[model samples]
Target: MKRRKVPLRMCISCKEMKPKKELLRIVKNSEGKINIDLNGKLPGRGAYICHNPQCLEKAIKHKLFERIFQQKVDKEIYVRLTDILTENDEDI
Candidate 1:
């Protein structure tokens, strides 16, 4: 069997390259709305972050999303992301 290549993405907070599925994706759609792309199939500009809360905080503190999206990220988006993370953490 041929060896398969794994898709990799860099975490904006940690600056670490990791398998795409291991990170969470955030996307900005055509309407300029930002959302967490849980399925990773949303059509839009995407940025990745690690599953850890520390990475999420670093990204927020440094305004990584604003830089990546080229616009201000609404507070609701951050709230939503944090909610999602906490929910996932509880399940683990």
Candidate 2:
């Protein structure tokens, strides 16, 4: 039997590749609304971020999401992502 291939995604903040299941997905839809896709099933342009505080900070510092989305990303979005990262960390 062959082993199933793991899907890999790059963390927008750190620019590092990691398994898709290990990262959070943020989506930009047709209406340009951005959302945090917890289940990885949202329909849109999705970007991944690892569960690391440092990565979130770096992305915020350099406005990484803004570059990818081609729009000004709100600070609240980063804050929310930070909260999610911290929550996930606590779970482990």
Question: Against the true structure, whose TM-score is highest?
Answer: 2
| Residue 53 accuracy (lDDT) in model 1 | 77
Q: What value of lDDT does candidate 1 attain over all alpha carbons?
A: 0.91
Candidate lDDT scores, in order, read 0.91, 0.89
Model 2 RMSD to the real structure?
A: 1.1
| Residue 27 accuracy (lDDT) in model 2 | 92
lDDT of 2 by residue, 1-92 (tens): 99999999999988889999999899999999889899999999998989988888888898888889999887778879999998888888
**What is the C-alpha lDDT profile of model 1 across 1-92, one tens digit per residue?**
99999999999998999999889999999999888999999999999998877788898999999999999999998998888877677776
Q: For model 2, what is the error of residue 24's alpha carbon versus the real structure, in angstroms, after optimal superposition? A: 0.7
TM-score for each candidate, following the candidate numbering = 0.91, 0.92
Best by lDDT: 1
lDDT value, residue 70 of candidate 1: 97
